[model samples]
Target: MTQTHTHTHTHESHPAIIKRLRRAGGHLNSTIDMVVQGRNCLDIAQQLQAVEKAIQQAKKALIQEHLDHCLEDLVGPLGAGQRKAMDEFREITRYL
Candidate 1:
């Protein structure tokens, strides 16, 4: 069975993050095309690596932004009981 967990941060992704993701998406598409065309293995690997790095960077930026803005605002005045849960969440995000 698959369980879904929900996050409370509903804010839109930062523009830079969006751009980064979109670029990564485009690169991913190009990588697919390259594979289909039987491009050199080394060239395909390089493109795939670029796509992977781009996506990783976008994810990192989004997570950082969430911690910077959403969590900062929410946690600032959280009650002691509430903060414990948020602190747990904060710790979890670090692994992402």
Candidate 2:
């Protein structure tokens, strides 16, 4: 049997996601500091939740960009390998 493959690449480096993740990390540190200072539980929880949401937003943006640019290219003018890659990407994203 002949095997065929399709490859897709992105020109956009997506630095914004990295910056957002860094900001989220800073928020997490602040939340930890609040906890260490004996702040109220509700306040700490709110800050932690904000960090989580920021991280989630960054993840969503990265995923959306990948789907829009990489996956779209793979699905067109390609073969079975590209479809397999898309399936793998979906599986990996299940954890996120």
Candidate 3:
């Protein structure tokens, strides 16, 4: 994708992204409270893990959405070689 890809305006911003992040923040706060309240170590670990997973989900959704919208728009008409590269690139992004 071109450098201008970041500037492309989609129909809506990352609403799901925001929601996941907010939920993660709430979990983090709860985790902190749990720590202060002498909760069981295993329970605290589980709460922290929940926070980590929520943040990770938000990150993955953001990357996939960017690829789906911005990259697809910028690479409007790909040639044979470019098409192969694009497809391979998409495959690699699955790691995100």
Candidate 4:
């Protein structure tokens, strides 16, 4: 007897996402450095908040892309991968 196995792969915008995240990280690092250098506390706080918001926006964009492209294919009619993918999505949403 012979057995066969199948694998499915999903597309991801990893390079673009990495570039966005790196830019956000650079903003965060600069903000922290300003704070450490005795910059105005209020200004530092505002800059930090801006960096956080940017990071959140990038994360949301990546999640939306995944839902539109990857999840759509995985959860298509008659597919069996929806539950697992949705569970992962739920876990990810907990942090958002």
Number of the top TM-score candidate: 3
**Local accuracy by lDDT, each model:** 0.82, 0.81, 0.84, 0.75
Task: Name the regions of candidate 3 deviating beyond 4 angstroms.
Answer: 1-13
For model 1, what is the C-alpha lDDT against the true structure?
0.82
Give per-residue CA lDDT, model 4, range 1-96, as digits (tens): 998548654346666777778888888999979978999989898888878877787787778777766666765753457667766775687477
Better of 2 and 4 by TM-score: 2
In terms of lDDT, the poorest run of 10 residues in model 2 is: 4-13
Order of candidates by lDDT, top first?
3, 1, 2, 4
Of the candidates numbered 1 and 3, which has the greater lDDT value?
3
> For every model shown, what is its TM-score relative to the native structure?
0.67, 0.65, 0.74, 0.62
Ranking by TM-score: 3, 1, 2, 4
Error of 4 at 56 (Å): 0.9
RMSD of each: 4.9, 8.1, 4.1, 8.4
Whole-model lDDT, candidate 3? 0.84
- If candidate 3 were superposed on the true structure by all CA atoms, what would the RMSD be? 4.1
TM-score (C-alpha, index-matched) for candidate 2: 0.65
> Candidate 3 at residue 80, lDDT?
92
Number of backbone collisions per candidate: 0, 0, 0, 0
Candidate 3 lDDT at 88 equals 85
